[model samples]
Target: MQTAQRNSLKLLQWMMAASLALPLALFAFASAMSWISTSEAADQEIQRTLDVAHEHALKVFETIDRSLAEVTEVIRGMSDADIVAREKGLHARLRVVAEALPQVKSVWVFDANGRALVNSLVSPAPDVDFSDRDYFRIPAERDIGTYIGEVLTPRPPYLGARFFSVGRRRNNEDGSFGGVIQASVLPEYFENFYAKIGREPGSFLALIRTDGAVLAHFPVIDHAVRFEPSGPLGRQIVANPLAGARTLQSPADGIERRMRYQRLAEYPIYVSAGLETAAIRSRWVSTVAQHLIFGIPATALLFGLLALAYRRTQRLEEEASRRIEAEEALRHGQRLEALGQLTGGVAHDFNNLLTVIRASVDMLRRQDLPEPRRQRYIDAISNTVNRAAKLTNQLLAFARRQTLKPEVFDASQNVRTLSEMIATLIGSRIEIAAQVPDESCLVNADAGQFETAIINMAVNARDAMDGVGRLTITVRPVNDLPSATTGPPNPHGHVAVSVIDTGVGIPPELFGRIFEPFYTTKEVGHGTGLGLSQVFGFAKQSGGEVTVTSDVGKGTTFTLYLPRVVGEHSPQSLLAEDAPSVDRANASVLIVEDNAEVGKFAADTLTQLGCTCVLVENATHALEELAVDPSRFDLVFTDVVMPGMSGIELAEEIRRQGLDLPIVLASGYSQVLSQQGSGGFELLQKPYSAEQLARLLHKAARSRRLRRDQAPAG
Candidate 1:
């Protein structure tokens, strides 16, 4: 009987091992499949984002082009000599027409000599030179039927405005060339026209110039404005402008995103729109996480039932189940950990994307659209951009990319302004008071960041006061005094912004560690513990510091010390140079550009500015052009990056040929220009407007002219 019992025990051990093995294999297979599906879903989400971006971008291009074409037609009508010679009578008629056209920021007539004959903005003045402007020269070249220039920030007659000027060459009644008729339109004219687009909270649309400068961003103030890609996806799209829909992880918040972008065929512009996956597929992620967590255990229970059925006829199966239980628990924990990491990565990318979209929208709002139809479309665009901004703020608050935009401003005024907002923020549970002096105290800090810091302090106070508290904010000028608790004397003049709360004070021991990232005193799900860290970061970034003064039951006061600017600091204006005369006498120009648009623009611009332009695509082409007739070209205008050889290489080749053709290398990126710095050659940035192009060509042409004039006349 004893021998029979030992054999049964061995058999039970084998059964236990088999039971664990069967469920383990099934669970492993299920986990792999789930992860693969999640990854594929993430990729699909990215593609969808790209598709949306492309459609929105295409719309911006079409709207801008169609509007310009319509304006061109209008200009063709005004080009009549009867209208041009009437002068004052024509001005009265134009004003009547301008008032009727809301999109027309300004409608002007230029004489054959490019002198302003009638301007809608002011009484016709000839002070400005239309001859040197792009709106005049670009259409005159007729290289492209229509054009869209880069966004120019607030200038004369258009304060804090961004608009595209549409132009067409005018002709005299005798069929001779008149000059040009032009109109500048703000995108707001089209804003309401495109209001049909339904964009999610975190989605955005942007109208970008060919060279990558943002022509118009939705939400103007909230949208991203930089030409190059800001986050990872933006970088990828820029690297390959022709890319269709694609997915990318943004570094700003580490969220997986979908982007759609398309370049306009006629204009040098692209319109793009994108959506965050979290906003679009939040349900999917939640479902995936839920099933992965609960499905395995439930499925395991089903397998256990099968095991019980097998053991029903065999009582010995229960003796060796400990090892099986241990293996199952370990495997389940492993799968959960993997899922967590995957989900976290996806969330981060989503948050980063929202941050960028919001910033882009903000930038877009800054654009001033004048065309009624275009402005209506842009208004719609602005709405979409604003939604994108709201989405980003949430994501940034989650991912901690939301930093401060500090400017020197009066501290007391800021505190006083926050009075109403703080009251609304704290609700009826907290009473707020501002103890600020009337004298102006300056602090270099972001108004929003300051408000957030105050809100956080108020919340902490409310919590200490057990959901009720009194909050007092004070601002004062800081002189040569050691801070409330500092070891050294103040050097930089400072302003003290203090938030005092009648709440349970923080322990002294926890003071130094409170500002550590992710360190929170609140319970789980209550906070991410980044509030104080953000406050700390804001202070440090503003060239200041945050100090705390608190006693066990004496309440807490968080004081932010910020550097004060002496007197005042105003924005410096770019030094403007008088337009130089185009002296092309005997100047020959060598133009190298791989892209036809840029190369043609440079060459035609040079020729117009009075130089013989020799066009080439690469270094080899330039060398070949020079080999045939070395003296044909006097100055070489080449792009830095080319197909066969670079601009630097081509310059070297010219030096080897013993030719001193003044070389002007143009590039879009500053890095390449910096690399060729001070090499006795001038470098011009690409996507240069007509005036800039004219200026650079003249500089090169005049330099060559001087060299020739100095040399013995051959």
Candidate 2:
């Protein structure tokens, strides 16, 4: 009887323990189901958000890609054009094309001689040359098409807007390049695309050119960026249709994000989209919370009536373990995506600041002052400018904005101009010898830029020789020169400018990256690692090619291959008699400039020049003045790169009305004007002194009379 009583007590104890365990197990199982379902839902939502963002980015890329496609079609048609007979047809067609495709801002054609044959908007000055542009130079290396230019204000003929260009070389029936066809699209057009794509709040998108310029970006991080493959992201998506997208936890927001990337099928562009983690997991957490609230009470009731609960607890613990592992993986992806965004953002902003400061300083040099004080102040300013310039050079080197500007020029003249500078550039310890043709060999190029490039080469040579060495500069034209087998191809009819240096030669390993930005053999502070980069930019910008042949411990030879200007050299017909000049006192002039300092300088100078100058801050104002009275002004002096309508465009409108009044183009970035051929229109380069300003005005006044005489009778 006593043993039976004890057994009954044990049974009761077991029953009570079972009752407690059943509810606990039921609650555990409910919690496990809720968490698993929530995690799956979160993953699904994350994927969905990523998909949506990706799709949005695709649309933006498609828009730009389609524009490139249109450009390609135009180029293909130009290749079949007859150089002599169809020059007019080609120019007219390009104009029609510009009008047809509102997306395209400007179109240009270059002859085999590197001269502007046809431009859609403005006629080039007869003297302007373009043999030194990369679009014409790089074709020799390979058949790489769809070249994108650095962000810049468009030159005349396509003025009033900043643009990025794409280029293609047209081949003759004999497979020789007939000419080059280039399409310059407004920079804002791409930015506008980014703006639309960036509609997503707190989201950003970037479109980088192959050369590493941030062509388009949402959020406007500094306007441009130069990134390298070896950047923090370790590799850049330079290939078509970026390989993949990654997710990351943002250091900025501390939020995990899902990212997706894709490259355009047509243009060389990579697009990426990021989805906030809160957005991705919002639905999942909501569903889980709802389930948890209902399951907790229901589980408690169910468990209260359950007889076996220990087994349920084991099942619940296993489910939680699996869910935790999956969540961890999802979290890891978010981190990688965030890193890419950070890298791009930093690079873009940093470059913008550098460009802004550099440009500002360059423009500041235009102010007039006493010789001694001016030189002293300029020296100080130049020191700072050089620092910024070096920074920009490195940025460009990395971004690949550094390119050649090839053109046919007089080799002897180039050397003669540099003789004085070269004397100072080369130390007393180094002997400099130059072998140049007496007659100017018409090779394509950017002469000023070339001089600087030569200076850099000389400096490098001096450093290598430890302030003692012999440097030889040779210039001559070569027939059927083989194109460079290096970075890009050399166009036909290339003229060679060779810089031979006797010094410690570069190691073979360093040769490959010697032109790379920030990659230097010199100790820090001694070099910014951009000397070779500048050389590269200069060569590419000119319609030419650059190659370096070096032997370790021997020396190095840098050769610039430039296209030749084919055609008989003819001197301009100078009028022996006195030509009529526009009366500045009676002439009303319109001035448009965005920068206050520049505008003020222009207004004051013109007023002092005896002209009735009306100053306006933007193209809009200038246009308004003309709209009120198209014949109100006899001349217009305008800034080419402005916030509103470009001076070139303003001139175009005036020209459209047959207003043959003189128009003067002004800008620090004169290269654009030279490329565009905004002539018979006069040009004044930025940082001009009072003397330069007066001379240009006097020239413009006289040229207007000559043009009036050339006009056809109605």
Candidate 3:
């Protein structure tokens, strides 16, 4: 009987649990249904809003198109004499037409030579030449029926506001092209009309050409007259030429929005309207919150009661399990965040570099450009390429993958050399105050990396100061150092190169994390978070360390401690030793590159540098050519990362064979070069300029000659 009573007690508990869970589940289902209904309604409302906006845009374009057509017809029927004479009747008709359409800014008729024959405004119009205008030139060249020109700032008699032109090609009685009848429409008209149509605060209305130029936009103050057709919006238009709706992230503001676009039937213009996702989500969230507010209290009450009853049964096990899980989750999240930041920064920087390169190349391809301007474009391309190479070098430094070509040089001299460049980079707002010791504090490290580190630190300091502050770069010898967050002291003594700035100082707690890759305190798009990481990597790789000292309101100092090298050589001597004069006459360069394009490029460049070139695909072929007659090649130019046999292996082979030839290994980023240490051979970083290649080749040839002369009498 006691056993039966215990079973009944367990059954009663189970029944109560079921009774509580059923209503809660049903309430959740009902809430989910309500949310779905609400979301659907919001989406429909957004569609309706877009439709209204599209219709309004279409009506505006139609009005402009009709007015232009009417003006074109009126001009075609009139004699050239009537237009040039500014006949009173013709002037009245033109004025009436311009007055009838609110969109029409002005109506003008031009003769075959592009002289302003007649205009709606100003009876005696100023002698303006319309011949140079794109609207006139395009129709005149293509002999098209109608053409729409890009937005342009209007001339006198009209306010200094932007307008787009709709022009029709006029013909003479003999069927020859007789200039164009151009009608201008004020962009403000469309902006004003769009403003009257209600929209959310962040919403935008835009009229864009099929080719991607922005004709007009609502909230005109924020709109750019020109937007790249290759941009996000342009790509979208190309994907769906007609009418469509899509969710896109705005490049302008980085906001995700649902955009509806329609291509106008009468004109080559398209209209787009966007509603921010945040606004839509807000409405949906409110609906969900309303249901949750009432249901949550009841649900919580029941769950709390059940939890209270069940707590003692599983508390210890649950607590221990949760603790382990939480720790693991935190670690995983941290790793993912770091990876994301690193990739994001790399992509952002490379994209910017590519944009500059692409734009410069495009400009260089223009045929009608003057010789001086053409040279300027070529120089711009070269400079941009160098900048890109530097960017990649910085990335390699941060990754600890770069092959450093360390040279013993004075830090003070390098700092002084870079002071002017630093001033320009940081802009006029920040004053650069460099204090270099009169005596050289020699250090063995890559001068380029050292300069890069200082520049990165200076830029960080500049940002911290909000672009306005005094920056002081000082180089002094440090005999003793206390080990702390900066790093351990070097037994060989160190040269302290410090970049000091009056900027917002870093917090103490973040000191340990600042050197970690992708760890930055800057806002997104403002920084890549790789600058400090590069500095840290560079300092550590150079047999030294980087340290920072800061005060909350005062300022901050970043010191790079490099092991001092006791040497008599000055910085200028080191530069002279590195770069030798090139006499490329009779020099034969054996180019070994696996990539066909790269091999061809190397051969062409060497030929241009006044060298006889022999191109080979790989190390085996290069060895064969050398074996045929080793003396035929004055220098062996090879890529480090190659298939079959690596450049380092080939260099080792050449040494093993006792070849008199000098080897120059080139690479953009090579693991082999980093691992094998360039085997004491001359290393050339890829994307090397013609001058750099020439100098390196010259140095290698000279080294070969010296080795030959040093050998015992043959």
Q: Per-residue CA lDDT of candidate 1, range 234-281, in tens?
A: 666667776555565433344555655666555566666555666546
Top of the candidates by lDDT: 3
TM-score rank, highest first?
Answer: 3, 1, 2
CA lDDT of every candidate: 0.63, 0.62, 0.77
lDDT of 3 by residue, 1-714 (tens): 344444444554674576577766876787678667765665576667667867876776667667767766666666788776655666677788788888877777778878777777867667777788889888888676657788887766557567889788888878788778878888888778777764665566777778877787765664455546777666767788887777777655567877777887757777777667787777667777877787778777776676655454233444555676789999999999999998889898888878877887898889898899888878878878878878887887566677576677878988999999999999999989999889878887788889999999999999999999899999999886546634434555889989999998988998889888788888989998889987877776565778899997778999998878784654442223346557765578899999898889878877887778999999999999999999878899999988889988998899899987878888878566533445445677777777766776666567767777898995
Q: Residue 73, candidate 3: how far off, in angstroms?
A: 3.4
Please give the clash total of every predicted structure, in order. Answer: 73, 49, 0
RMSD over all Cα atoms, model 2: 35.7
lDDT of 2 by residue, 52-74 (tens): 54565456444444544564465
Worst 10 residues of 1 by lDDT: 569-578
> Of models 1 and 3, which has the larger lDDT?
3
Query: Per lDDT, what order, best first?
Result: 3, 1, 2
Which parts of model 3 are misplaced by more than 4 Å? 1-42, 222-227, 251-254, 304-714
